[model samples]
Target: MSQQTGSLISCTFVCLLLAFFAGQSLPVEGANILGVFTSHSPSHLIIHMSAMKALAEAGHNVTVVCTSVPKVTHKSIKQIVIPLTEEEEKQLNAGMTGMAKEKPSIINTFKNLLGSLSMYIDKQVDVLEDKRFTDLYKNKDNKFDAVVFGFFFNYYQVGLGSLFNCPLILSWTSAPMSIVDESVGNPELIALVPSMNVAVKPGQAMNFKQRLANYFGTTLFRFIGFYLETKNVVFYDRLWGKIPDMISYDEAKKNVSLALCNSHAISEGPVRPNVPAVIEIGGIQIKEKPDPLPQDMQEFLDNAKNGAILLSLGSNLKSENVKPESVEKIFETLSKLKQRVIWKWDDLKHTPGKSANILYKSWLPQDDILAHPNIKLFITHAGKGGVAESLYHAKPMLALPVFADQPNNADKLVQSGYGIRVDLLTLEADEFKASIKELLQNPIYTKNVQAFSKLYRDRPMSARESVVYWVNYVLRHHGAAHMQSPLVHMNFIAASNLDVYAFLAFVLFIASLISFVVLRFCYRKCCGGKGKPQKSSQKSKVKKH
Candidate 1:
């Protein structure tokens, strides 16, 4: 009996010690994080991967649900490949390729329309309704502290966060514009308001009309995007039982708890109206040491004793689609240039000559090449990744923007005096050569770019940390209800229209009433004949006349 009692006591003591340690260790355990990145764009991929790695470093379990359409590799995060059906893949490819061609066919237009619909319904809805996602929520055993939705164009990912019943944080892979960051209270500047406009440099004040145009332009874009999102939501509601429509701004504002903009105020210049909830976390994906250049690339960079020029039209625009005239111009222009050129011409082969001055590659380690000492000028299509990388590396650029946000990025770069813009369609070989030569010769452009780079990098904290902090804030606050904008919940006209017409009507009515009263008094004074009452006959005569 004594031996049994002693053994029991020992076991009890061991159990108590284990329980105490377990309780203590529970506070620091890993958090479950679900990051939805549906955009096939490389920039979106980079930003999502960077944030995922950061969360992992902070002892969080991250699961990324992305499509294998573009085929990206992320080691730290568990990537679930959402494969596209063959027909859907063909339709999508047709849209992208067709858009680049001269005058899209009716079939291409139809395909694009179908593609958009499928993106909203088939791709997005299918992913959300998958057994893996449903099981995650239904198991009751699994829970996520937060869900990060990173996408360039699609707002539907916000639905996944709502479905998971976790804090929703939006990561925008573009500059902090009013439309996306409006909920967070950041209003884009009135481009027409010269005083409100943040000049790119001294003595370059934007006129009031220009400022107003910029403001309205951005607002219109946002409104269109919001409209499309709402339509998608309504469509989804009809198909799927009233699941929360995350695409709607009003719905997202209510459901989405946090906003993380992938931009810096400094590089984007000054925004007239700033919102507290809209956190600027630019250069979030700037890796300390990016992957090394491939062997062929290293050899080319090594051979270029003179500085090399990097020319890339980005991932979306194929070099083959470039007009033959433009191609000849670019090749001719590059041939005249003194600097060696490394062009990412994915589908092209056979150089104009054996000058060994130009090197061609299908894929290039862009960041690594930018960081190289011998790389002087970056001629690019002004995509977000290239823009961010150029800014991060302090490299000046010759921006030949093709489509979408590339034009905006290029405009900002040129307006900031950090780069020059060349219209791809109208560019001549001599003009292209001249601009490149000018940019290379000018020290101001390089100096300005480096200055911007300093400000972009000198933030209070890393962008990853900012995102993590906000995500934790949402978790700790039991949903960041306070961060949401009341405006997002209001009707579009009420929120943005500002009732200017109503105010004008009210003012006109008051003015007309005041004028009539004044006129009546004046007539009485004139017709009274020095304080004597005017006869009814005089009034009748005036009326008849």
Candidate 2:
């Protein structure tokens, strides 16, 4: 009996010990995260959505409040879609269209967008007041550990971070521009680094015209930024009117902890300095392996006697909006080519005539299509996301930039030796045909892009991996407050050290003045006083005579 009892005791002790270790081994629950993206642009939403999905997959409960909720499979992600009104949609379309048609001058583009900026801000205010955001705000038990804001022009909505008492993160679709960099207290380096809107390469020195363009672009961007910030203060006042713990517009921006930019040095050149808070997760949308192309797409590519070409104008523009003649010219050129063509056309009825070699689709799986071994060239609108993807795939491009960053992207692609640019507005069949023929016939474009693709993909960690690592890194450290630049906390005078320099200058000036007075006094006593005595001596001599 005693032996049995001893055995039982030993077994029980072993069980208890196992249970203790097992409990310790289990992972801790992740912190809750909130992501606010008010912009209705699909491209911007993709970057933010990718981040939210990464956080959710990392065992965090993520709540995304956006104008349109993206499709996410993670169980931890909660999406709240704040839909845009019909008129707001029209305004958004108009803004893009108008900017595309703006005069070639950078200043004129900024001037045109100024009126639309206020309307965008007002729409964002509606997002903050939405029942979904209000419910989260009012719910005493609902707390978030961090908040991520889409860093479009909507700097005002960063106040959500303060309202929720959490760390704020800004996600962008491109590298940090001067305005975005300034918000995080990063150096602008206006003379060296090309403006985000310009395509000057890193190694190349800017010519007089390029320098002029960079300066004008940087100035115009800042002018618009100031106007938006000024407008934001008013909208924020109405948004935060009743809250007892109100944070000012300026204070809210300073609290931003990290900026996740969609840029990599290999593809997007002109690499410049960055603070620790700025993280580049370029090509985050790319998958480790391309998804299997649809059956029809697979068959289409397989059946092509010659290599295929993919033409996409990106998500924002409609094919119907392109002038009919321009469409006809593009088709006229493409139809002559023996290679198969796949174009992203929204309207089936408004296509650029039918051709045996051309396939028209309302939407194409762009990344997958580009990945196919048979695709020889990509004719694109030069959107940044598309540009990044094409670089990753190493496909030669023929850029037909429509508007916004497209012009800049197209210019850089040409500079990089990867492609040629044809103004979509002035595309002639002859020029379009020649550009397409050149990319296909020459091996240099293909060689340059393929070399770049290797570099772009040869990162220590993949873009998605970087995103997941940083999201958890921030959560582990409880906000990267150590990474925040001192400049963010400093006033203009203090940040520039102008006050200290002025004090030194004043002290030096005072010392110099005192030295001059002392020297003059000594000179007068030693030289001038003796001269007066000499004059007395001369007068005595005169008396004697």
Candidate 3:
């Protein structure tokens, strides 16, 4: 009896020990994470908030700082809303409208989207003053394991890192621009990687002209990128000025732990190198399984035996903004098609006009609709989110890009053999109709996109799983200081090793100068000495005679 009792005690002790270690790990797994997602666009918000949603589902206590309410939410997530006032709203819209009307280039696109110093910076600086947001850092008792900033070339968000004393994770909405690469010191080699505004086939090399354009684009990109972030130094300092354990803007940026980008390098073109600190989690905004379609729309797609087209201009560019004639061209082409149409129109009551073959809904589940087998083609503005969805579902696109990155995305679409791009501003009904017919008739579009779909979805871990693992990784490892890049710490001279080259050049110059002087001295001495000896011999001979 005593032997049995002792054995039971041993087992109990072992079980209790294991429980202690398990309990110790729970805090790391269920971290208190703070997320700042203050970009103004609705689509951009969805992409960033999706990361927070993943954290909440993983049992983290996620508190988000955002401009508007996020479409993605979780029970464990709490949001602090600091919406823009009416005046700021007008300023932001005016900035967007002004940029859209400007000339098109990679630099202009940068300013159009994430940049334009005055628009994004001034608005974000205002966030620093909002009491609701300031309260997070002001309180001494509050703590967070990490701070995930929905990045947009703005540096003031770095203040969250200092305030919370945690690892910083950046959530970028699209592929790396030169500025995005600067965040984690990820290299953006223009030779190997095309500009974000430029697209090539998945594994193709650039031609001479492409390389030349890329060089110019990359230089301007770096300048604009540096200007955009460096311009925010005043606000960054002001926000963290009096706080304890304050760090300089430069130091704060260097300490950033990771950048979770919304792009798949392999599936998307311009495949490039990445540091350990950078990860691609594109299509995280897409649902795992599509929700059921609403009744009328369900029947509409159900009976689309000839297949159907899904059209959306994205949330940022409204239907009203579209030229009335362009809208007419789109409607005219779509109405005449044998295929059915599901258009995302903002005004249901005042749609362009009635059509027997078209069903217009003010709001639609974009990805879910794309997932349907009946969805033959997607006509979009080529926004990042829409592109990800279409790629995920293997649906070809008829791109009618308006502004910002849409044109670049359109370039990628045609380049991939999946779709064609037309000028939305000058769309003709004949051209629009012909492009749709070409995509439908051509089985290559379907085959090519379908093949890429496999590459896109074939990942070691799903996007959400990666988000959970990495976020927990940072928390458990205490700010993940080891994951930082050496480049982040280096000055421009050091990063490029320009000083090393300069020293080598100086050494070569000194060595050459010494060799030249020594040769000249030796030549003069030998020649002059030989002539003197000959002259002396002649004098001696004459004297002897």
Candidate 4:
């Protein structure tokens, strides 16, 4: 009995020793994350949520502070929803409605920013002051490894990352722009890379005029962004300035660990330059296998004998906002198409006069619907997220661009021969119908887009995978400060080497002045000395003669 007891004790000791070693070898616990996505646009929210959902799936604890409730969320993620007030909702809708009527140009778009930006800023400040978001910091025990923010011209929100003393990960919904680039110390690249609001053809060279327009458009918009940021400085100081050991807003701005942009340079062109810190997860929102469509939608799509067309103006569209006449024209045009149509109208009770072939849904699974085999053309507002999905699904698009990047996105789409673009505000029945028929009849658009889709999906890792890895990487490396470009910390004078150039110029100027003075003094001294002797000697010679 004693020997048996001794053997059991020895075995237990061995097992305990092995367990300790195994525990040491196992991976550490997942990091805690905070997501701040306060963009007024719902499409921007979709991209931000997709990225946060990825982090949660990778075993991290993610807490999101967003203005609107997300349609799709992960079990592991918790949300602190702060919806806009009824007044704010009206203002946002009104702003979008007013914007849709304007002729879509980079100038006109930015020309309208000042009036609408304040509303967006007011919305952000309101979200910051909310008790639910404040409680995260009020309770001292709350800790986060990183704070991911959706970049909607809100630089002040970087203070939250500062308040948490964690990495600030910025999320941009389009390709690199001066606005996004300036945050992470990326070069302006204005010569080659057009602003997100200005679209250039994928592979086409920019003419002098195009380049000139890009330069001015980029500068003016950047100034517009800077102006808006300056206005938000007060809000930033009010909320985050008082915390002890708090990093300054300016410091936090330069310290952004990285940015994840929803753009693929390979598929979407003007191949500029990028720093290591900028990660392009262009089609991050696209699912590898799209979710199953609604039974009715599935049936509708399955029954599409002639290919189908999808029309979505994105989250901002409202029946009341769309001019009735324009609606009549659009309806008259779409109602006559041979292809079946699925219109994502906001109001189901009173849609744009539905036809037998048209299916109206208040809400749509856009990505899933695009992935359907029968979807031949996507008529969209050309928002980055929608364009990315359509491109991923290899569906050609007809863009009725209204404002922001839509006009630019439309121009780029047309250049790629993917589809045509028409002004939504001035769309005529004949033109709209002709554009649709052209895309449907042309095999070139379909062929070009399909080939591009192959390249888009050929990434070494998927966008979701990229998000998980990079977020963890930032956590592991303590903000990945080394990957940051030196430009982030540099002022314009220092970054442009203007200071060095000025110093060199001063030195050269001083040297040149000294040389000129010395030469002048020596010449005068030698001439004066020699002249006096010659005059005196000639006078003496004249007296002797």
Best candidate (score: lDDT): 4
What's the number of clashes in each of the models? 7, 0, 0, 0
Per-model TM values vs. the true structure: 0.77, 0.90, 0.91, 0.91
lDDT of 4 by residue, 248-318 (tens): 77787787898999888977887878998899999888999999999999999999999899999898667
Residue-by-residue lDDT tens digits, candidate 2, 263-284: 8865566667788888899988
What is the C-alpha local distance difference test score of each model?
Answer: 0.69, 0.81, 0.83, 0.86
Candidate 3 lDDT over 259-337, as tens digits, reads: 8889888778667789888878899988888989899999999999899999998877667767778889899889888
What lDDT does candidate 2 reach at residue 486?
A: 84
Model 2 spans > 4 angstroms off: 1-29, 69-76, 103-105, 116-118, 207-209, 535-545
- Model 1 stretches with alpha carbons more than 4 Å out: 1-29, 69-74, 85-90, 97-141, 188-205, 238-252, 335-338, 348-355, 492-545
Candidate 3: TM-score?
A: 0.91
Better of 1 and 4 by lDDT: 4
Question: Better model by lDDT, 2 or 3?
Answer: 3
